[model samples]
Target: MYDGAIIMESLRVGTSLEAFPLILRRLSRYAVKTASADQPPVWTEFVFEVADEHAVELADALAEVLDQPGWYADFHNDEENFVIYPGRVFRYRRGDQLARAEAQEHGRTLGVPEPQLDWTD
Candidate 1:
């Protein structure tokens, strides 16, 4: 299973994520507290599962929809990890520290806070 989580708040204006048929198998929602005035105090995260075969489609969709300003989506399967930012997607082996660092650095360059750059490997 390809498990991933997306914060509902991270979506860009006028953009809606598609509920890919037979791809998204499960979903869960949770609230995250934020102090920024630009965002709601409680942000809802939509955690989901997808079939591994749809990784490319998922990455492409996420790359297009994630906001350009520091927003990203992370998902992983048994052997690979995907880190997606607006207009960009990074694929790395499960345990590649170098690739992870590169992705994190890219996030930082996008003005993503260091804490927000934390994504499961």
Candidate 2:
């Protein structure tokens, strides 16, 4: 199984939420959380775990939908991490700091606040 979290508030208009309900169906567990951050104040997310098979679909959908400019979402399996930015997706080995830094730099350039770029592996 792969664990992932998608910020509900970061979704952009014109993108399909068709994947949302489908993702929930396979989830082993889930909960909603309002992120504790200062930039945008509170960003709510749906934290969940779905079968590994959903990773590709989830990444693609998130890339298409997440509002760019400091907004992103991520999920990971034991061996890999998938970070999705608007129209972009980055997959790197877990604990790979170099690869993680590249994704972070991209996020920074997109105007994502520094603190918001932190995603635990």
Candidate 3:
């Protein structure tokens, strides 16, 4: 099932952050297995990066969001370095169009394919 299902369940019951991890754990029970090496379970984490030039502001913003439960790291390979859960990943982008553009640039630099963009008429 998609993460939306888990989120919706949480929202319906008014879950708190303290309780979010437990909900995530329960959701993991229903996760479908992939062909990855070990078929890791699903959990959530926040992935982020900032240019060395903007490190300070990025650090401050990261600090502000750290209270939320999720792993944080700068390097993509380092993500697999820690296993609080399995098959968990989240990418964070600073708000606004400029930030979105920069994220696309960074993704390209990392050899990640650009995501398809859609606009509703």
- Who wins the TM-score comparison? 1
Each candidate's lDDT (Cα)?
0.79, 0.75, 0.28
Per-model clash counts, in order, read 0, 1, 0
Candidates 1 and 2 compared: the better one by TM-score is 1
1-121: candidate 2 lDDT, tens digit per residue: 7787776667875666674434442322233243334234555556777677777887887888888556888888899999889899999999999999999999878777777677877
Per-residue lDDT, model 1, residue 84, is: 94
Question: Per-prediction TM-score, please?
Answer: 0.84, 0.79, 0.24
- Which residue pairs clash within candidate 3? none
* Candidate numbers, best TM-score first, in rank order: 1, 2, 3
- In model 2, state the lDDT of residue 89: 95
- The sequence of per-residue lDDT tens digits that candidate 3 reaches over residues 31-84 is 423212322244333323323444333333333333222222232222111111
TM-score of 2: 0.79
For residue 77, model 2's alpha carbon misses the true position, in angstroms, by 1.8
Model 1, 1-121: lDDT tens per residue? 7888887777888997676743444454555443234444565666778887788898899899887666789999888899999899999998999999999999888777777778888
Question: What's model 1's overall lDDT?
Answer: 0.79
